[model samples]
Target: MLRKIESKNMGSSNLGWLRSKFHFSFAEYYNPDNINFGVLRVINDDLIQSNTGFDTHPHRDMEIVSYVIDGELTHGDSMGNKNTITRGHVQYMSAGTGVYHSEHNLGEDTARLLQIWIYPDKKGYEPNYGDYRFNWKDRENKWLHMVSSKDGDAPIKINQDVNIYSLELRKGEEISFPVKEGRQAYLVQIEGNSLINEIELNERDGMEIVEEDILIKGKETSHILILEMSKED
Candidate 1:
């Protein structure tokens, strides 16, 4: 099964400094039917104005992942981990029990990023923070293994049985992924345009896949993100 979600159809929130599009129920965009996809709870495509950002906030029992698309995102947490993640970099924070953190864009250009929240397998795990700087060339024309439960090629590890992959496909390039039974996937077009199994997807557009193989062809130079996880019973 496949369901395509247009970018404009997503829930939107426009604060003075922060503009966001919610892929699932988030903040004020509550929709019971659109709450989540398996263990994936939230995907907030955010644009933060220069010199402004989210102040220190508390989170618990959630696996938070941040993918910086443009500009720079500065992160600071109570754990004394502070870093600026640039494009092609990923940041992960497991708010097991509880944790406080802040995200800000101190650069001159507007910062664009995807803030994702996934439910942990169980609560009360230890809180942790880490990040990885990925080389852009590694994902060019092929999938780049980013995050996974089994820690081998993936640089970051989470507490759930999920795998995350990214790709930067040049025009006319194509890639395929097999879908095992009892598993599902969510895909998002980060930049440019592409066709997922012949369905067109523009920037910020997304689709949910279940029990079907994925074939992605780049109509133009495209950046894509895929999250595959176990299907909920």
Candidate 2:
């Protein structure tokens, strides 16, 4: 089955310098019905004003992924690693036992991105960090695996039975995948328009798919993120 989570239906919060939309219950946006779908626990669309961002915070027992859409984001963590994440770049932080990190907008314009959190298959693993640049040209009209179980393939590795795909499609482009039977998936449109099994989705729009044999089609020049997850029986 397919269900649409309209952009307007998302929970929002405006904290002056930071404006965020939560696709699932996050922070103060609590909803028992929308806690999560499969192992995908959090999908937060964040737009940070220039010269502002999130301060050092602690996280544990979760796999966090950040995708920068525009401008620059400077990341620094307790692991003694610091880096800049720009458009088309992804940063992953495996908060196994515990970790503290901060993100700052390093551009004059607003920095937009999606910060997603997933429940790991096992906890108390060693914390780690990784960042990589993904070429849009290589993924044109195709799905690029941006995150996976193993490292060196997608730059970022997480401890979960999940894979994340980033796709940039032309107006008439399309793609299909035979998902594992009995698993679930979540699609988040970061920009432009697209259609999943003919269901229209705009910017910041999301959907939870419980059906198998998924076919994703884009209706325009669009940027989309798909998280394929393994469901627990």
Candidate 3:
């Protein structure tokens, strides 16, 4: 069955400098029924105005992934790592024990991004950081595996058994992937509209899918994030 989490129902925080939408109970937003889906804990879509951002914050026992949609985001962490994440970049920080980090919009225009958190499978491990840039042209027409536990071509590593894919589909394009025998997945439409398993989803809409094989067909030029997970069962 397909169930959608509409954009209007998502918790929102509107500051003069930033606008955010929370997919799960986060910070001051609390919804018992919307706490999380499987190991996926948080999905925050943030648009930060120029010269504004999130200050240094602490996190532990969580895997944080950031995907920038527009402009640039400057990141600095306790690990002595600092970098600017732009469009088509994936940044992963494993705050296993504890870590402090801050993100800011460094561009003249607003910066938009998706910040996702997944509960790590292990606990008390050392904190770590990683990042990679994928040329949009190479992966634009298909699904690109950006994060996973597998050791092959995946760029980001996580302390969990999960796979994350980003796709930029032109109108009329379609994609499909199989869920492991007992696994589940999440389909998040980042932009435009799409149909997954016959269910229509607009921008910022999401679904927790637990069925076997999954198919996605884009109704318009679209960008989507798919997280294939093992903890849903």
Q: What is the C-alpha lDDT of each candidate?
A: 0.94, 0.86, 0.87
Write out the backbone clash pairs for model 3: none
Alpha carbon lDDT at 94, candidate 1: 95
lDDT of 1 by residue, 1-233 (tens): 88999999999999989999999988899989999999999999999999999999999999999999999999999999999999989999999999999999999999999999999989998999999999999999988989998444588999888898989999999999877899999999999999999999999999999989989999999999999999878
Q: List runs of model 3 lying over 4 Å from the truth.
A: 150-153
Cα lDDT over the full model 3: 0.87
Estimated TM-score per prediction? Answer: 0.98, 0.95, 0.95
CA displacement after TM-score superposition, residue 131 of candidate 2 (Å): 0.5
Q: What is the lDDT of residue 188 in candidate 3?
A: 82
Where does the lowest 10-residue lDDT sum fall in candidate 3? 149-158
**Model with the higher lDDT, candidate 1 or 3:** 1
lDDT at 98 for candidate 3?
A: 99
Model 1, position 204, has a per-residue lDDT of: 98
